[model samples]
Target: MPSCQPLNRMKKVLTAQAEAEKIRRIGEAEAGSIEAIGKAEAEKMRLKAEAYQHYGEAAKTALVLEALPKIAGKVAAPLAQTSEIVILSRDGSRVTGEVNRLLAELPVSVNALTGVDLMKIPFLQKMTNPQA
Candidate 1:
Protein backbone atom coordinates (compact mmCIF):
# COMPACT_ATOMS: atom_id res chain seq x y z
CA MET A 1 0.00 0.00 0.00
CA PRO A 2 2.93 2.34 0.74
CA SER A 3 4.41 1.79 -2.71
CA CYS A 4 1.03 2.34 -4.30
CA GLN A 5 0.67 5.68 -2.47
CA PRO A 6 3.99 7.02 -3.90
CA LEU A 7 2.99 5.92 -7.40
CA ASN A 8 -0.37 7.70 -7.07
CA ARG A 9 1.35 10.91 -5.83
CA MET A 10 3.76 10.81 -8.75
CA LYS A 11 0.84 10.41 -11.17
CA LYS A 12 -0.90 13.51 -9.69
CA VAL A 13 2.30 15.62 -10.03
CA LEU A 14 2.76 14.56 -13.66
CA THR A 15 -0.86 15.43 -14.42
CA ALA A 16 -0.45 18.90 -12.95
CA GLN A 17 2.68 19.50 -15.00
CA ALA A 18 0.92 18.45 -18.20
CA GLU A 19 -2.02 20.78 -17.47
CA ALA A 20 0.32 23.74 -16.83
CA GLU A 21 2.09 23.09 -20.13
CA LYS A 22 -1.22 23.09 -21.99
CA ILE A 23 -2.28 26.37 -20.38
CA ARG A 24 1.03 28.00 -21.32
CA ARG A 25 0.65 26.93 -24.96
CA ILE A 26 -2.87 28.34 -25.05
CA GLY A 27 -1.63 31.70 -23.71
CA GLU A 28 1.13 31.88 -26.33
CA ALA A 29 -1.34 31.22 -29.15
CA GLU A 30 -3.67 33.98 -27.88
CA ALA A 31 -0.76 36.47 -27.75
CA GLY A 32 0.24 35.61 -31.32
CA SER A 33 -3.34 36.13 -32.56
CA ILE A 34 -3.47 39.56 -30.92
CA GLU A 35 -0.23 40.59 -32.62
CA ALA A 36 -1.55 39.51 -36.00
CA ILE A 37 -4.74 41.51 -35.47
CA GLY A 38 -2.71 44.63 -34.59
CA LYS A 39 -0.64 44.28 -37.77
CA ALA A 40 -3.77 43.94 -39.92
CA GLU A 41 -5.36 47.04 -38.33
CA ALA A 42 -2.20 49.09 -38.95
CA GLU A 43 -2.15 48.05 -42.62
CA LYS A 44 -5.78 49.06 -42.99
CA MET A 45 -5.09 52.49 -41.51
CA ARG A 46 -2.15 53.06 -43.86
CA LEU A 47 -4.23 52.25 -46.92
CA LYS A 48 -6.98 54.60 -45.80
CA ALA A 49 -4.49 57.46 -45.39
CA GLU A 50 -3.13 56.92 -48.90
CA ALA A 51 -6.59 56.88 -50.43
CA TYR A 52 -7.51 60.16 -48.75
CA GLN A 53 -4.37 61.89 -50.09
CA HIS A 54 -5.16 60.81 -53.64
CA TYR A 55 -8.77 61.95 -53.30
CA GLY A 56 -7.71 65.39 -52.10
CA GLU A 57 -5.40 65.86 -55.07
CA ALA A 58 -8.08 64.79 -57.54
CA ALA A 59 -10.58 67.20 -55.96
CA LYS A 60 -8.16 70.10 -56.26
CA THR A 61 -7.52 69.29 -59.91
CA ALA A 62 -11.26 69.12 -60.61
CA LEU A 63 -11.80 72.52 -59.00
CA VAL A 64 -9.09 74.12 -61.15
CA LEU A 65 -10.53 72.59 -64.31
CA GLU A 66 -13.97 73.95 -63.48
CA ALA A 67 -12.70 77.48 -62.83
CA LEU A 68 -10.28 77.85 -65.79
CA PRO A 69 -12.87 79.10 -68.33
CA LYS A 70 -14.24 81.71 -65.93
CA ILE A 71 -10.72 82.90 -65.16
CA ALA A 72 -9.90 83.26 -68.88
CA GLY A 73 -13.09 85.24 -69.59
CA LYS A 74 -12.37 87.67 -66.76
CA VAL A 75 -8.87 88.30 -68.14
CA ALA A 76 -10.11 88.83 -71.72
CA ALA A 77 -13.27 90.90 -70.97
CA PRO A 78 -11.46 94.23 -70.84
CA LEU A 79 -9.76 93.78 -74.22
CA ALA A 80 -12.86 92.52 -76.10
CA GLN A 81 -14.97 95.68 -75.67
CA THR A 82 -12.52 98.17 -77.20
CA SER A 83 -13.50 99.73 -80.56
CA GLU A 84 -11.27 100.78 -83.46
CA ILE A 85 -11.31 104.18 -85.20
CA VAL A 86 -10.15 104.44 -88.84
CA ILE A 87 -8.58 107.39 -90.70
CA LEU A 88 -8.22 107.28 -94.50
CA SER A 89 -5.00 108.66 -96.03
CA ARG A 90 -3.98 108.94 -99.75
CA ASP A 91 -0.24 108.94 -99.14
CA GLY A 92 1.94 106.38 -97.17
CA SER A 93 4.09 109.19 -95.71
CA ARG A 94 1.01 110.96 -94.41
CA VAL A 95 -0.31 107.73 -92.82
CA THR A 96 3.02 107.13 -91.06
CA GLY A 97 3.08 110.72 -89.78
CA GLU A 98 -0.41 110.41 -88.37
CA VAL A 99 0.39 107.09 -86.71
CA ASN A 100 3.46 108.54 -85.01
CA ARG A 101 1.42 111.49 -83.81
CA LEU A 102 -1.32 109.19 -82.42
CA LEU A 103 1.23 107.01 -80.66
CA ALA A 104 2.83 110.04 -79.01
CA GLU A 105 -0.56 111.25 -77.79
CA LEU A 106 -1.71 107.93 -76.23
CA PRO A 107 -1.75 107.71 -72.41
CA VAL A 108 -0.99 103.98 -72.05
CA SER A 109 2.05 101.93 -73.07
CA VAL A 110 1.79 100.68 -76.67
CA ASN A 111 3.84 97.56 -75.95
CA ALA A 112 1.44 96.49 -73.16
CA LEU A 113 -1.65 96.81 -75.39
CA THR A 114 -3.13 93.71 -77.03
CA GLY A 115 -3.55 93.12 -80.79
CA VAL A 116 -7.15 94.21 -80.20
CA ASP A 117 -5.85 97.66 -79.32
CA LEU A 118 -3.67 97.80 -82.44
CA MET A 119 -6.73 97.08 -84.58
CA LYS A 120 -8.51 100.01 -82.85
CA ILE A 121 -6.11 102.76 -83.95
CA PRO A 122 -7.89 105.19 -86.35
CA PHE A 123 -4.75 106.35 -88.19
CA LEU A 124 -3.78 102.72 -88.99
CA GLN A 125 -6.90 102.22 -91.11
CA LYS A 126 -5.42 99.29 -93.08
CA MET A 127 -5.49 97.10 -89.92
CA THR A 128 -9.26 97.69 -89.44
CA ASN A 129 -10.28 97.69 -93.15
CA PRO A 130 -11.43 94.21 -94.21
CA GLN A 131 -11.40 95.07 -97.95
CA ALA A 132 -7.64 95.76 -97.95
Candidate 2:
Protein backbone atom coordinates (compact mmCIF):
# COMPACT_ATOMS: atom_id res chain seq x y z
CA MET A 1 0.00 0.00 0.00
CA PRO A 2 2.90 2.42 0.67
CA SER A 3 4.52 1.64 -2.74
CA CYS A 4 1.19 2.19 -4.53
CA GLN A 5 0.80 5.60 -2.91
CA PRO A 6 4.25 6.76 -4.11
CA LEU A 7 3.58 5.47 -7.67
CA ASN A 8 0.23 7.34 -7.84
CA ARG A 9 1.92 10.62 -6.78
CA MET A 10 4.61 10.17 -9.48
CA LYS A 11 2.01 9.55 -12.18
CA LYS A 12 0.05 12.66 -11.16
CA VAL A 13 3.21 14.80 -11.28
CA LEU A 14 4.13 13.55 -14.80
CA THR A 15 0.58 14.23 -16.11
CA ALA A 16 0.64 17.76 -14.68
CA GLN A 17 4.02 18.38 -16.27
CA ALA A 18 2.72 17.19 -19.64
CA GLU A 19 -0.33 19.48 -19.39
CA ALA A 20 1.93 22.45 -18.58
CA GLU A 21 4.12 21.71 -21.59
CA LYS A 22 1.07 21.46 -23.88
CA ILE A 23 -0.23 24.85 -22.61
CA ARG A 24 3.18 26.46 -23.18
CA ARG A 25 3.40 25.19 -26.75
CA ILE A 26 -0.13 26.45 -27.49
CA GLY A 27 0.76 29.90 -26.14
CA GLU A 28 3.90 30.03 -28.31
CA ALA A 29 1.94 29.09 -31.44
CA GLU A 30 -0.66 31.80 -30.81
CA ALA A 31 2.05 34.40 -30.25
CA GLY A 32 3.81 33.47 -33.48
CA SER A 33 0.55 33.71 -35.45
CA ILE A 34 -0.20 37.13 -33.95
CA GLU A 35 3.27 38.39 -34.84
CA ALA A 36 2.93 37.16 -38.41
CA ILE A 37 -0.46 38.87 -38.81
CA GLY A 38 0.98 42.14 -37.45
CA LYS A 39 3.85 42.04 -39.95
CA ALA A 40 1.47 41.47 -42.88
CA GLU A 41 -0.74 44.35 -41.77
CA ALA A 42 2.31 46.62 -41.50
CA GLU A 43 3.44 45.67 -44.99
CA LYS A 44 -0.01 46.42 -46.39
CA MET A 45 0.00 49.85 -44.74
CA ARG A 46 3.49 50.60 -46.07
CA LEU A 47 2.42 49.82 -49.63
CA LYS A 48 -0.64 52.05 -49.32
CA ALA A 49 1.54 54.87 -47.99
CA GLU A 50 3.99 54.41 -50.82
CA ALA A 51 1.16 54.65 -53.34
CA TYR A 52 -0.08 57.88 -51.74
CA GLN A 53 3.40 59.35 -52.04
CA HIS A 54 3.47 58.71 -55.80
CA TYR A 55 0.09 60.27 -56.64
CA GLY A 56 0.95 62.66 -59.46
CA GLU A 57 1.36 62.84 -63.24
CA ALA A 58 5.12 62.34 -62.98
CA ALA A 59 4.56 59.31 -60.83
CA LYS A 60 2.00 58.05 -63.29
CA THR A 61 4.52 58.49 -66.05
CA ALA A 62 7.11 56.57 -64.06
CA LEU A 63 4.64 53.78 -63.47
CA VAL A 64 3.88 53.67 -67.20
CA LEU A 65 7.61 53.57 -67.96
CA GLU A 66 8.04 50.65 -65.56
CA ALA A 67 5.17 48.73 -67.13
CA LEU A 68 6.33 49.45 -70.70
CA PRO A 69 8.58 46.40 -70.85
CA LYS A 70 5.79 44.11 -69.72
CA ILE A 71 3.35 45.76 -72.14
CA ALA A 72 5.81 45.45 -75.01
CA GLY A 73 6.42 41.79 -74.21
CA LYS A 74 2.66 41.09 -74.22
CA VAL A 75 2.08 43.06 -77.44
CA ALA A 76 4.99 41.29 -79.21
CA ALA A 77 4.32 37.80 -77.79
CA PRO A 78 2.52 36.59 -80.95
CA LEU A 79 5.64 37.31 -82.98
CA ALA A 80 7.64 35.08 -80.63
CA GLN A 81 5.64 32.00 -81.67
CA THR A 82 6.31 32.63 -85.38
CA SER A 83 8.91 30.19 -86.65
CA GLU A 84 10.09 32.69 -89.26
CA ILE A 85 9.44 36.39 -89.91
CA VAL A 86 9.30 37.60 -93.52
CA ILE A 87 9.68 41.25 -94.44
CA LEU A 88 7.48 42.23 -97.40
CA SER A 89 8.95 45.70 -97.83
CA ARG A 90 12.64 45.67 -98.87
CA ASP A 91 13.25 48.97 -97.01
CA GLY A 92 11.75 47.34 -93.86
CA SER A 93 9.32 50.30 -93.67
CA ARG A 94 6.37 47.89 -93.31
CA VAL A 95 7.77 46.39 -90.12
CA THR A 96 8.81 49.78 -88.75
CA GLY A 97 5.40 51.25 -89.60
CA GLU A 98 3.61 48.37 -87.92
CA VAL A 99 5.74 48.83 -84.77
CA ASN A 100 5.07 52.56 -84.80
CA ARG A 101 1.32 51.88 -85.18
CA LEU A 102 1.45 49.47 -82.21
CA LEU A 103 3.43 51.96 -80.11
CA ALA A 104 0.91 54.72 -80.97
CA GLU A 105 -1.68 52.86 -78.88
CA LEU A 106 0.54 53.05 -75.78
CA PRO A 107 -0.77 56.44 -74.58
CA VAL A 108 -4.39 55.27 -74.90
CA SER A 109 -3.55 52.00 -73.14
CA VAL A 110 -1.82 53.91 -70.34
CA ASN A 111 -4.86 56.18 -69.96
CA ALA A 112 -7.18 53.16 -69.82
CA LEU A 113 -5.05 51.42 -67.20
CA THR A 114 -4.22 54.43 -64.99
CA GLY A 115 -7.11 56.82 -65.67
CA VAL A 116 -4.58 59.40 -66.89
CA ASP A 117 -3.10 60.21 -70.31
CA LEU A 118 0.68 60.06 -70.54
CA MET A 119 0.97 62.37 -73.56
CA LYS A 120 -1.13 65.05 -71.84
CA ILE A 121 1.19 65.02 -68.79
CA PRO A 122 3.10 68.36 -68.84
CA PHE A 123 6.83 68.21 -69.39
CA LEU A 124 9.22 70.30 -67.26
CA GLN A 125 10.21 73.46 -69.17
CA LYS A 126 13.94 74.06 -69.47
CA MET A 127 14.67 76.93 -71.89
CA THR A 128 11.33 78.69 -71.39
CA ASN A 129 10.58 79.00 -67.70
CA PRO A 130 8.53 82.23 -67.83
CA GLN A 131 9.25 82.83 -64.15
CA ALA A 132 12.96 82.85 -65.01
Candidate 3:
Protein backbone atom coordinates (compact mmCIF):
# COMPACT_ATOMS: atom_id res chain seq x y z
CA MET A 1 0.00 0.00 0.00
CA PRO A 2 2.80 2.47 0.73
CA SER A 3 4.32 1.99 -2.72
CA CYS A 4 0.89 2.45 -4.35
CA GLN A 5 0.40 5.76 -2.46
CA PRO A 6 3.68 7.18 -3.91
CA LEU A 7 2.70 6.14 -7.44
CA ASN A 8 -0.78 7.76 -7.06
CA ARG A 9 0.81 11.00 -5.81
CA MET A 10 3.19 11.08 -8.78
CA LYS A 11 0.30 10.54 -11.23
CA LYS A 12 -1.70 13.46 -9.72
CA VAL A 13 1.31 15.86 -9.98
CA LEU A 14 1.91 14.90 -13.63
CA THR A 15 -1.76 15.46 -14.53
CA ALA A 16 -1.79 18.93 -12.89
CA GLN A 17 1.39 19.96 -14.72
CA ALA A 18 -0.04 18.90 -18.08
CA GLU A 19 -3.26 20.84 -17.45
CA ALA A 20 -1.28 23.98 -16.51
CA GLU A 21 0.82 23.77 -19.70
CA LYS A 22 -2.31 23.42 -21.82
CA ILE A 23 -3.86 26.51 -20.21
CA ARG A 24 -0.67 28.53 -20.75
CA ARG A 25 -0.54 27.59 -24.43
CA ILE A 26 -4.21 28.54 -24.89
CA GLY A 27 -3.66 31.95 -23.24
CA GLU A 28 -0.66 32.69 -25.44
CA ALA A 29 -2.60 31.80 -28.61
CA GLU A 30 -5.52 34.03 -27.60
CA ALA A 31 -3.16 36.96 -26.91
CA GLY A 32 -1.43 36.49 -30.26
CA SER A 33 -4.77 36.43 -32.11
CA ILE A 34 -5.91 39.61 -30.37
CA GLU A 35 -2.68 41.39 -31.27
CA ALA A 36 -2.97 40.34 -34.92
CA ILE A 37 -6.52 41.65 -35.11
CA GLY A 38 -5.44 45.00 -33.62
CA LYS A 39 -2.64 45.35 -36.17
CA ALA A 40 -5.00 44.63 -39.06
CA GLU A 41 -7.47 47.24 -37.82
CA ALA A 42 -4.71 49.87 -37.53
CA GLU A 43 -3.58 49.23 -41.11
CA LYS A 44 -7.09 49.52 -42.41
CA MET A 45 -7.49 52.92 -40.70
CA ARG A 46 -4.24 54.23 -42.16
CA LEU A 47 -5.22 53.28 -45.71
CA LYS A 48 -8.63 54.91 -45.34
CA ALA A 49 -7.09 58.19 -44.16
CA GLU A 50 -4.73 58.30 -47.14
CA ALA A 51 -7.59 57.67 -49.57
CA TYR A 52 -9.60 60.52 -48.07
CA GLN A 53 -6.70 62.96 -48.40
CA HIS A 54 -6.22 62.05 -52.06
CA TYR A 55 -9.91 62.43 -52.70
CA GLY A 56 -9.87 65.96 -51.25
CA GLU A 57 -6.99 67.00 -53.53
CA ALA A 58 -8.76 65.60 -56.56
CA ALA A 59 -11.90 67.53 -55.70
CA LYS A 60 -9.94 70.78 -55.45
CA THR A 61 -8.36 70.20 -58.87
CA ALA A 62 -11.75 69.50 -60.41
CA LEU A 63 -13.16 72.71 -58.97
CA VAL A 64 -10.29 74.78 -60.42
CA LEU A 65 -10.73 73.20 -63.83
CA GLU A 66 -14.45 73.92 -63.79
CA ALA A 67 -13.96 77.59 -62.88
CA LEU A 68 -11.17 78.33 -65.39
CA PRO A 69 -13.30 79.05 -68.45
CA LYS A 70 -15.60 81.45 -66.61
CA ILE A 71 -12.67 83.35 -65.12
CA ALA A 72 -11.00 83.67 -68.52
CA GLY A 73 -14.19 84.92 -70.16
CA LYS A 74 -14.65 87.59 -67.51
CA VAL A 75 -11.12 88.89 -68.05
CA ALA A 76 -11.36 88.83 -71.88
CA ALA A 77 -14.73 90.59 -72.45
CA PRO A 78 -13.52 94.16 -71.77
CA LEU A 79 -10.45 93.76 -73.96
CA ALA A 80 -12.59 92.49 -76.80
CA GLN A 81 -14.89 95.52 -76.48
CA THR A 82 -11.98 97.99 -76.56
CA SER A 83 -10.59 96.58 -79.82
CA GLU A 84 -13.78 97.58 -81.70
CA ILE A 85 -13.11 101.35 -81.38
CA VAL A 86 -12.06 103.01 -84.67
CA ILE A 87 -9.28 105.66 -84.75
CA LEU A 88 -9.90 108.40 -87.40
CA SER A 89 -6.42 109.96 -87.69
CA ARG A 90 -5.13 111.11 -91.10
CA ASP A 91 -1.79 109.39 -90.63
CA GLY A 92 -1.67 105.57 -90.23
CA SER A 93 1.17 105.91 -87.71
CA ARG A 94 -0.87 108.39 -85.66
CA VAL A 95 -3.91 106.07 -85.69
CA THR A 96 -1.74 103.21 -84.49
CA GLY A 97 -0.32 105.43 -81.76
CA GLU A 98 -3.82 106.46 -80.62
CA VAL A 99 -4.91 102.80 -80.52
CA ASN A 100 -1.90 101.97 -78.37
CA ARG A 101 -2.64 104.86 -76.02
CA LEU A 102 -6.27 103.72 -75.60
CA LEU A 103 -5.16 100.19 -74.89
CA ALA A 104 -2.69 101.36 -72.24
CA GLU A 105 -5.44 103.27 -70.40
CA LEU A 106 -7.51 100.08 -69.92
CA PRO A 107 -7.69 98.36 -66.49
CA VAL A 108 -6.51 94.96 -67.79
CA SER A 109 -3.41 93.96 -69.74
CA VAL A 110 -3.96 93.97 -73.55
CA ASN A 111 -1.21 92.08 -75.37
CA ALA A 112 -2.95 91.42 -78.69
CA LEU A 113 -5.89 92.72 -80.76
CA THR A 114 -8.65 90.44 -82.12
CA GLY A 115 -12.12 90.42 -83.86
CA VAL A 116 -11.40 92.92 -86.70
CA ASP A 117 -9.11 93.20 -89.70
CA LEU A 118 -7.67 96.72 -90.14
CA MET A 119 -6.95 96.17 -93.88
CA LYS A 120 -10.61 95.33 -94.55
CA ILE A 121 -11.83 98.74 -93.33
CA PRO A 122 -12.40 101.43 -96.12
CA PHE A 123 -11.12 104.32 -93.93
CA LEU A 124 -7.68 102.63 -93.42
CA GLN A 125 -6.64 103.43 -97.05
CA LYS A 126 -7.14 107.17 -96.57
CA MET A 127 -5.31 106.99 -93.23
CA THR A 128 -2.34 105.23 -94.86
CA ASN A 129 -2.28 107.60 -97.91
CA PRO A 130 -2.49 111.12 -96.41
CA GLN A 131 -1.91 112.92 -99.78
CA ALA A 132 -4.93 111.22 -101.40
Tens digit per residue, CA lDDT, model 1, 1-132:
257888899999999999999999999999999999999999999998887577754464455445646866897799688786576778889988987887654423432432123334444446446565
Give per-model TM-scores: 0.41, 0.46, 0.41
- Candidate 2 local lDDT, 13-128, one digit each (tens): 99999999999999999999999999999999999889967687677677777887898799889999899976677778888989988767767787787776666644523222
TM-score: model 2 vs. ground truth: 0.46
Question: Candidate 1 or 2, higher TM-score?
Answer: 2
Measured by C-alpha RMSD in angstroms, how accurate is candidate 3? Answer: 21.9
| Model 3 clash tally, residue pairs | 0
Q: What's the true lDDT of residue 20 in model 1?
A: 100
Winning candidate number (TM-score) = 2
Candidates in order: C-alpha RMSD to true structure: 22.6, 7.3, 21.9
Off by over 4 Å in 3: 57-132
lDDT (CA) for every model shown?
Answer: 0.67, 0.79, 0.66
Residue-level lDDT of model 3, residues 2-118, one tens digit each, is 578888999999999999999999999999999999999999999988775776544644554456468679988788868476557777998778778875443122212232233
- The runs of at least 3 residues in candidate 2 whose Cα sits more than 4 Å from the true structure, single-residue gaps closed, are 1-35, 46-54, 70-91, 122-132
